[model samples]
Target: MALYKQLALGAGLAALLSTAAHADLSGKVIGFSQIGSESGWRAAETSVTKAEAEKRGVDLKFADAQQKQENQIKAIRGFIAQGVDAILVAPVVSTGWDEVLTEAKEASIPVVLLDRGIDASQDLYLTSVASDQVKEGRVAGEWLVKTVGDKPCNVVELQGTVGSSPAINRKQGFEEGIAGHANITLTRSQTGDFTRAKGKEVMEGFLKAEGGGKSICAVYAHNDDMAVGAIQAIKDAGLKPGSDILVVSIDAVPDIFAAMAAGEANATVELTPNMAGPAFDALDAFLNGGTVPEKFIITESKLYTPADNPQGEYEARKGLGY
Candidate 1:
């Protein structure tokens, strides 16, 4: 699987580099309406997006929506008024985007979605750049199922923001992954809002409700930040995180690796923060050569465990603004 990921990533990068060389975004103004820095991975994504824009000489106008759909809609309107060449949005939720997206389309402004997908029509945006969120969740679930074997296990899920695509899709995929595993039951699930503080608080409630963490066998967090927070909650309750309650999550952020190195987290699915690379590539093609890119440009999602050199992984990603 590692070799396959390397080959796939290499091919994708080669294609992107070729497209980038042929198309120039220099001096082009692009607006990025970001979902706020709610997690470490989100922060890394924002940092990488900025770096990619700088590298391509694109003038990037950024706005932080602070996890609010209204703020994002306002930012998009602001970008349209400025008549920017293109717009990028990491929507906070899937619904309520049709109206704003339609406005962008009517203005002849191509909008590309990042990370999370929206429930709006395909024609509303140029393309969506994101990982297969369902697959990430399934991978985490499969890991738990395999590790727990035939033993009966109770799992609790720490979900992302309510109504968000990641939270919904991930929850569905995890259920699918553990469908036939009769021994593993999802006992409780609740929203963590994809934040460390909220994750910790919700986990504390779960621990209290689940016999002080004794009944829970594992925790499935929608993101690494939540997993890290849950680990702290477990410690506060005088329980070993990885040993007492197996921790599995998506988004292979640096802190998650640090936890894995310390034996606090068991596994994570890698959700690369470089969604902007393909989004930028698509914009360059459309703007320069009038080429129409694929409607959905998917990125790779790989699973990581402690055996994958967690300490090295932690060091490698620690400097990427996460």
Candidate 2:
């Protein structure tokens, strides 16, 4: 009887130790609302974020908004209802986020904006992890201006989604870049919805309005997918891309590197896709009773031209998903 009692006591103590070790996490849950897998980069971001959460032993609740603002709002409210410890939102648009964010703040839940920017007051959210979109546009524009110096150039612009931050900032930055360049003018500007199909449609319209490539000197796409789509349109019109219509854009996806290798694309600005590393780091710090600043974490971007795209380095990075 004495030996049996000692054995039972040892078992109870082992169970108690195990429970205490597991309780170190404080049983925190993280909720993430993604803006749908519209692009390769977006899909990569979602995948990496999920993997990061799992690796960190965070109970992550994920919601896909299917690229709709209403869906995102609904998902955020759901997270609030579930009383998640933290929430991450990749908003579809810049506006219409203040109310949902306010609710999270009221609940004392920290919200992080990922890959996109919001127009609301900064106090509504904790931090934003995104690329300097305007700077990306400026880099592309500078390359174009240098390539076509002193020549009267008519350019067609393939903008991103109508109200997204990348669309707004890229447009503004490109306009700023070409401000004093008298010889370069934007002949056509339209939204491509950040997809290849819409990019092709918009490019076809630009070709018809500008009389094909005869009058159009270049194409400036907000993303590589659009640029790739426009390349097909240029080809179908019997014009040689990179030679007849110089192509420049952002997002160094694998396809764009292929285009550059084939001489269909002239230049691109790279936007890295692996945003999960920094995001998880920030969240871990915040969860450990550490205060994080209102950070506007900007990822580094590089301009890639044919002269520098050797052995398909852009293609290799594209597999990395952002």
Best by TM-score: 1
Candidate 2 C-alpha lDDT tens digits along 1-322: 0110000000111122233222223356888898887656676667766756665677889999887899999999999999998898888777999899999999999888887778999989888877777888888888888999999999999998777667887888788888899999998899997778888899999998886568999999988788999999999999999999999988777788888899899998876554544565566667775868547766566777888743456555555554
The 0-to-1 C-alpha lDDT of every candidate, in the order given, reads 0.84, 0.76
Candidate 2 has a TM-score of 0.72
The parts of candidate 1 lying over 4 Å away from their true place are 1-28, 35-39, 64-84, 91-109, 118-121, 150-152, 160-165, 190-216, 236-239
In model 1, state the lDDT of residue 246. 97
Q: Can you give the TM-score per candidate against the true fold?
A: 0.75, 0.72
* Predicted structure 1, TM vs. truth: 0.75
Q: After superposition, how far is residue 131 of candidate 1 from its true place, in Å?
A: 3.4
Superposed on all Cα atoms, the candidates' RMSDs to the truth, in angstroms, are 6.2, 13.8
Query: Any residue pairs clashing in model 1, and if so which?
Result: none
Residue 39, candidate 2: alpha-carbon lDDT = 59
Clashing pairs in 2: 272-322, 273-322
